[model samples]
Structures are given as structure tokens and as C-alpha cells.
Target: MGSAREALLDAAYEAIVAGDWTGARMADLAARAGVSRQTLYNEFGNRDQLVAALVLREAERFRALTGQAAREAPGDVGDATAAAVTAALTAALDNPLIKATLTDDTSGLLPYLTTRSAAIMDVFREDSIAIFTERWPEPAEHPEVRAEVGWISETAFRLVISHLIVATEPVETTSRHIAEVVRRLMRDLTTT
Candidate 1:
């Protein structure tokens, strides 16, 4: 959050974008950030920690962007969910890190977005739960409803992630379909 820390993360991100994470050096990143190597180490502890920080930051950024989209979307829950997915896909297309990762299949950064995605998932899960709660307003006594919402949130997140990694359709079509699925799931929950 501090300027120095943010700068270091930016530098690290730029390095990863320019080439791959394996080629990124702590010293080079420090220089790019206009900070000493010691400063970078002090801020991030080590390379792995720095990498995690960078990945988590990007995940948080994605969540924030998509959350805003869902909030601003018109119509009902289905429409908002569609907007969120659309925003996510659009943002991914414009993200340099995502572009680089996709182009360089061997970047080894895919784990951050895939298998090792717990932190990223957690970020989205929290936001999704809040949004779901706001839209549905399940009472505290209705633990089953809350559990259903949590399941839906995770399902939606996995769907989004799947689309990000492997696009089979247009963004609009994919988002609309995802929204429909979400709406149907919510409808089922309400009806039962």
C-alpha cells in the first residue's frame, strides 16, 4: 500500500510481463522500483513472498473491478452477474500480466491463477458472499440458505476461472449463459 511497496510490486509485475517470472531478479526489480535490494527484501522478505504478494494484488484488483460492475449493472441478479463476468473477461483481455501468461504457456505463473488459487478464490469468495447476501438477504436462522449461497458463489467463481483459462464462446454469450445458470440456481434455492 505504501508507495515504495507498490512500486516494488509494479516493478516485479513489469518484469514478469516483459519476460517470465523465472528470469525476474530481485536486484533488477529493486532497481526498477528505484529502491535498494535491501529495501525490496525488507518489504517482501524474499522472492516467493514477493511473488505471492504480486499475484494476490492482481487477484484483488480483478475482484474489485468485477464487484463494481455487478453493483452497477441494471435489471435483476442475473443481469448483475452477467455484467460481473463480462467485466472480468474484458479486464483479463486488457491485463498485461494475463496476456503475458497466456502467451507464454511455460511461464510457471499459471499455478497462481489455477491450482494455487486459494488466495485468489478467497478474495472473490468474500466479495461474492457479500454480494449474494445483499441480493438475497437470507436470515441467520436459515443456515441452509446461507450454505447454498456459499456453494453458488464458489460455483460461479470456478465457472469464471474456467472461462478465463479456456474460452469456448464470445464473452457476451459466455457471460449471459453463466448469468442464466446463476439465476436458475438461485431460483431453485428459493423454490426449495
Candidate 2:
């Protein structure tokens, strides 16, 4: 069952990479995966479900890559965040799903990253909170620290999303700017 599901996802990814996701029929996807149409439907329910699965998979991949980059970077949490953001932006530059979504405004896939991004953003938010909490633990008598951490996470994640949607500067430059902002915020929190 898992193999069939993976095959279906693989087939869908291939279609997207080939620039045919908008035109690819369920039957064609099932044929590519060597599965029946019923099997595909049973696995994913519909095209939107399949797309959600694909986007979630990509989000997990992003999380892993960014987590590793953060862990391996030198200096403080801000430095780690910069490395993670840089890794994500660099990956986005060549990521087929991102490319397809950005280049084809009519594909109807933009919602998965924008208005309908709760599921994806939830994953990123949880991960960011974990990373930040570990780096800056809550102090005794400071219950508001958690809220501050959440705000930082949301702000940083939104910045990355905005860049992905509307890139104005180079990846490294934007990444560094984000890091500096985060660093200032953290410094203020520490001093206050």
C-alpha cells in the first residue's frame, strides 16, 4: 500500500516537473504509476489531495534541510537562522515545485503556499519554535518568553515566505537582513 502511494506521488511529481500537472489526468498518473484509477483515487481521493500530499512532502524536506543548516552553522541563534534561511532560499531557486508555482500563475497551486498554507505553516512554526526555544530558553518568572518566541518564529517564517513569493534582493543579502532583524529582536528581549 505504501509503495503504491509513493509511486503515485512520484508520478505526480514527474508530471509537475514536466510542466503538465495542470493538464495531467488521473488516469495518466495512475498509468505512469502502474496503478489503477481506483487505486489512485483510493490513495489520494482527488487531485487537490494529491497536491497537498506533494506540498507536505516538500515542506518536510525543507524542514529537514533548514534544520540541518541551522544546527551546523556557527555563532548564535540569529546566525543559525540566517544559514537556514539561506539554505531554504538557495533550495527554492532550483526546486521544481516552487518554480512551477511561481512561473505558472494560472496553475492554481499558489493557494497551497499562500491563503491555504496553514498546514504547511504549522509545521514550520512548530519547528521554528523548537529551534528558538532551545537556543533561548524561557527564564524563571518570564512566562511571556514563549509568546515572544512564537512572534519571532512567525515573523521569520513570514519573511521567508514573502521572499519566496516576491524576491527583490539576492538570497544571501535577504537572508543576512532577516538574521540581523532577528538578532536585534533577540538582543532587545535579552536586555529588557
Off by over 4 Å in 2: 138-141, 190-192
Per-residue lDDT tens digits of candidate 2, residues 41-111?
99999999998998898899999999889888888778889999999999999998899888876678888
State model 2's lDDT: 0.85
- The ten-residue window of minimal lDDT in model 1 covers 132-141
Of candidate 2, the 10-residue stretch with the lowest lDDT total is: 132-141
Which candidate wins on lDDT?
A: 2
- For TM-score, the strongest prediction is 2
TM per candidate: 0.91, 0.92
Expressed as tens digits, the lDDT of each residue in 2-102 for candidate 1 is 99999999998888888846776789889999999999999999987888899889988999999999889877667878999999999998999988777
